[model samples]
Target: MLLNMNFIVKALLGLCLVNSAFSARILFVMIAPSLSHHIFFRHLIKELSFRGHDVVSISPDPMNDPKLTNITEIDIHTETYDAFDARKWLETVQYNKPSSEISLMRSFLPLFYTQADNVLSAPKVQELIQNKNEHFDLVIVEMLMFNAHLFALRERFNCPAIGLASLDTSLNAMDAIGNPTDPNYYGSFFTEFSGGNLSFWERLQLLWHHIDFRLYYYLEYLPISDAMIAKHFNITDKTAWDLEKSVDLILTNTNPIFHIPRPKVPNYIDIGGMHMRERKPLPKDLKQFLDDSKQGVIYFSLGSNVKSTNLPAEKRAAILNVFRQLPYNILWKWENDTLPDKPANVLIKSWLPQQDVLDHPNLKAFITQGGIQSMEEAIRSNVPLICMPFGGDQKFNARRIADLGIGRRLPFDDITADTFLDAITDVASNPKYKKSITKLASVLWDQPTKPLDRAVWWVEYVIRHGGAKHLRSPAADFPWYKYLMLDIIGFILAVVIIALIVIIKVIKLLFRIIPLKKIKLKEQ
Candidate 1:
């Protein structure tokens, strides 16, 4: 019996060792200033910490989670630059140019660089780099902006680097991983084209944007970001352009089931709904609102970035005016307490438990900005949406919503009381909208593993394997002309031309010989 007990103890110890093997020291750099954008990384951090891994996160808004003992938080303040300023983009939208989004990105890159540079230059980051004792198994970076700067962290820790895209339809991340971005298959996040099989004209437009985007990065974004990396990291051996190509994996925030279907490299893992969770109890007030609504509730939110309160007086009135006409009880996520004429049916909250409220059985419709989070929540809950996009991929997501028959997108400039009223009525009254989203939710939930589990597993897989270098596509090494097959096309064209010239010369020589032979025969 004593011998048996000894064996059992040894087995138990082995089990403990096996369990402990999964734990990793991970470095996460999330410099995205936007609150909603930060949530994606926050969920990833939380998941890693729960799995008994040690996570050191550098973020603008750090989650001071006392529960996760292994997680370390380093704060970077970028509220001034990162905070959702609707006014800036709203003015750009007024221009009605397709390139307007590109212009906004150009304006925002300076501020994005400022925050990235500040985080790298922070004393804590510097100390971490200088400390020889500090080591990490992996480094994860949000690839929204400042990919180059975060790569510096990967080198500092001497570990594998993984990029997590903050938004869905990240053409930049797709391009960086050497994933094909053919206009025939993929739509620009700026456009509302559901680009599965695009028309000739549609493909041309997408191609133009594709070419312009490569030019923009090569000419503008990369050079400036390289300067920031050069200054802060003090490394002469590599430029930012070089570091950007070295990422081991890209954790994309996209679900092909919900997104425009396109080819992705094996390294680009889709963990789009990674943040989705089992429903928790709603806040007391929110619960009461849903409980009290006999006719069901309409939840309206522009996500965290675009403040509904930032809407101009006329726009605000237009939205409020629609809510007044709706029969169902309205729950609008207004940033401010007071609005001009909030009807009796409408209830305004500074912040609402968005996921919890979406989970409510009493939810008839969601009036949302086409933020992927909001759309995912609405889809997960199997509720229909009325998408009035503010900026960024909201428009793209909105278009997908409409294309999928899950929602309708009406532009803000054209969003009158009648259009808003009609959209709410159409989505709410139609059972097909709810049905379509429910079908999509099934495919989203029907993954081999839960998104969070897949995400954690991939993260640990990178750790266990030391790095994901094998998954790296050879395409990243190719220049534009080579990757696009332009060189091969040029070579093929030259060969064909030379062959035709040889054939023509042979025909001419044959004719000359035949005529001379005929003359000789006639003389004979």
Candidate 2:
């Protein structure tokens, strides 16, 4: 018996050692100022730390949870918020403005550049970067806006890096991972055009935008970012492009149910809705309000970044006018102490537990700005949407909701009491929108692996393999001409031109000989 016990103890000790070896030390950087964006990264960060990884997180929003002992949070919220006032930017957005992706990016680049500089200069970030004694097995970075932090992949820590995006893959992210930017079918977040059935003008506009955006990015944005990287980190050996291509994998927040299906490389993984968790109980007042609403409730919120309080007085009145006439109760996320001229049936709250509220059975329709995360929550709860997008990807997501037959999209600038009432009534009274979204939600939940688990698995896979270099697409190495097969097309055109010339010359010579022979015969 003693001999058997000794053998079992040794085996158990070996397993513990193996488990310890697998736990990685990760440097997770999520410095974006938006809270909605951070929520997604926060879930992943907590999951990794809970799974025994020593996660060092650098973010503008820190969870500061004392129970999460495995994570070391480096806060840069103050500096980042100061650099870019999200609220001011949101307030200034023209809801009626058309999409001009290149122009929009051009205006935002300087702001992002300044924000990146501030993030790097923050005391905690500086200390973390300069600490040569600290090492990590992996580094994860949010690949939106500014990617100056990518310099850490090589210059600061010689380890593999994983790029994370809070929204569907962007043109720059696709370019970095060597994935095809199928602009014809997959119009970017800023553009309303998506899918293959495009008009002649739409096709023309898309192609022009693709070329124009690429020129601006490569010529202007890239050089500025490269200079910033060099100045901040003393990284003279690699440009921003070089660092972008060094990414081992890209995890995008996209799903086939929500985003158009497109070709993607192996390393470009979709872990959309990874932040989704089981619905919790709602607060008593909200719960009672929903329970008492016999006609059902319509939920309204513009999401975290865009505040409803900032809506123009006319627009706010229009929304309120519609709410007053509706038999159904309204729950609005107002983001203010009180709403002026509020309806008796409508309840306004400064903040809401959005997911829990959506999960309530009495909730019928969602009036939203069509943010991706909000759409995911609504889809899961089988709530149809009435999207009035303001800016950014919201336009694309709103258009998609209409295209998918999951709901309706209203133009914010075009909205009035009648239009608002029509949209809400159509979406809430009609059964088709709810049914379509329900079917989509089923598809979303039918995946073999849960999104969070899949994300965690990929993170660990990178650690286990030391890098996902083998999975990197070969197209990443191809230049523009080669990738487009322009060389082959040029060669084929040359051969055809030469053959055509030879045939014409031979025909001319034959005609001349025949005319001379006829003249000679006549003279004889």
Candidate 3:
């Protein structure tokens, strides 16, 4: 019996090994110039390589890890940044206004075209495309403002492709995937209004914004992208819009904890915090600072794109004045080497391990620019927030954070020492903020599978099945009129109008006949 059991165990082990050996060849393209964006996607790329799949990654930031044997990194860092200067663009942001969310779709149209053309025209990419031997089982491209990368799906690789976003799904992406964009219920990511509890006027504004943006995207933006993509790929057959619609799946960095809950097609998956991992040990000075802070620490950062050094001198002084009076020790992610009149209770660093710092036991609250990734880190660490939004979905994130009772939102441009002090002290001392975030963290983590695992599984599922076409919503292929059933409504209205006309004519004819009959009777 013992001999038979040993043989059975060996057979089971062999079967498990065989199942784990399944791997796919994937083409991953992420050309966005922002490091925060790349940081979120890097987790998936490394995870796939570790699982033994062969991955060719074209990205601004490559893993460059010698141990990632299965990954072939093609660096496009210089090409992308040269086309779009992120820091210069950020410096131009208007911070003094109540609404910082500008019309990026309109303002950045030329930059998008430039970026797409530059990446596609790069020599490395050209060689990869020209090489006839190059093939892939699946293709994954960043689905942000640029669509030129999608050309690889049909023009080059001729395989299944997936769209990935480092932020919440934008209006353009929602339309591409045939996901429902109910203006009344679901506001666009760029909009300041959160989904629920909108007044009538707000709803109308949301509706108008939705229609105006969609029309601009289809009529104006898409044509430019299509032209650039066509020119680079040397393709005459299909437009860039066609390739975007053909994407088998979209993996977005969004979650219901902070995002508005809405209906989604099977192909769109939320893997928001996939980049989050086990916290690492903080550097010696940083660890000592946090540990020694008897009153607790407040972490502040404006994310990768926005720099604190770019703040107006007056605004900087106002912020410092508030920090000087606060009892809490402050750790600010300052970009510059020096902060004039640096407070005794404050520590400034050009860079910090954000996640590790947030997880510290001495952390009281986080004062942030309210980027989605920063919010996710704060929530995962069960830390409350004081959100001072700078730009680009930060306003919306701040609103949601306040609505959820996990934090407070303050205007960055209109900051005063008194208001800033109030926000800091309220969030740091309030028990409700801690309780709300703790409860939310529990809900956010109560998933059947870890987000990264789910993302990898879906990527492999596409390879295994040769595409997730079966999961694609029919709404994606439907024209605007057909999807909204407007054609059917119009047909019904036409039939009703014709029937009313015929009935009125019949009544008039009967009246004439009855009057003629009465006249004949009188003559007789």
Query: What are the per-residue Cα lDDT tens digits for candidate 1 across 349-399?
Result: 998888889999999999887888888888889999988886777878877
Rank the models by TM-score, top first. Answer: 2, 3, 1
TM-score attained by model 3 = 0.94
Candidate 3, position 207, lDDT: 85
Superposition TM-score, candidate 1 onto the true structure: 0.93
RMSD per candidate (Å) reads: 2.5, 2.2, 2.6
Candidate 1 stretches greater than 4 Å from native: 1-12, 79-98, 517-524
Q: Estimate the overall C-alpha local distance difference test score of candidate 2.
A: 0.85
Candidate 1 positional error at 354, Å: 0.8
The RMSD (Cα, Å) of candidate 3 is: 2.6
- Native-to-model Cα distance after best TM-score fit, residue 51 in candidate 2, in Å: 0.7
Error of 2 at 54 (Å): 0.9
**RMSD (CA, angstroms), candidate 1:** 2.5
lDDT of 2 by residue, 1-524 (tens): 99999999999999889878888999988877888988989889999988889999988889999999999999989878887865545444565342575776677778877887888888888887788797899999898645744545555788889999888856777887799986577667767768868887887777777787788778878887787778777887788888878889989899877888888899999898998998898899989999999899999999888889888899989899999999999999989888889999999998999999999999889999888999999999999999998776888898889998999999888899999999999999999999999999999888999889999999999999999999988888888898899999999999999999999999999999999999999999
Which regions of candidate 2 are displaced past 4 Å? 1-15, 86-92, 95-99, 148-152, 512-524
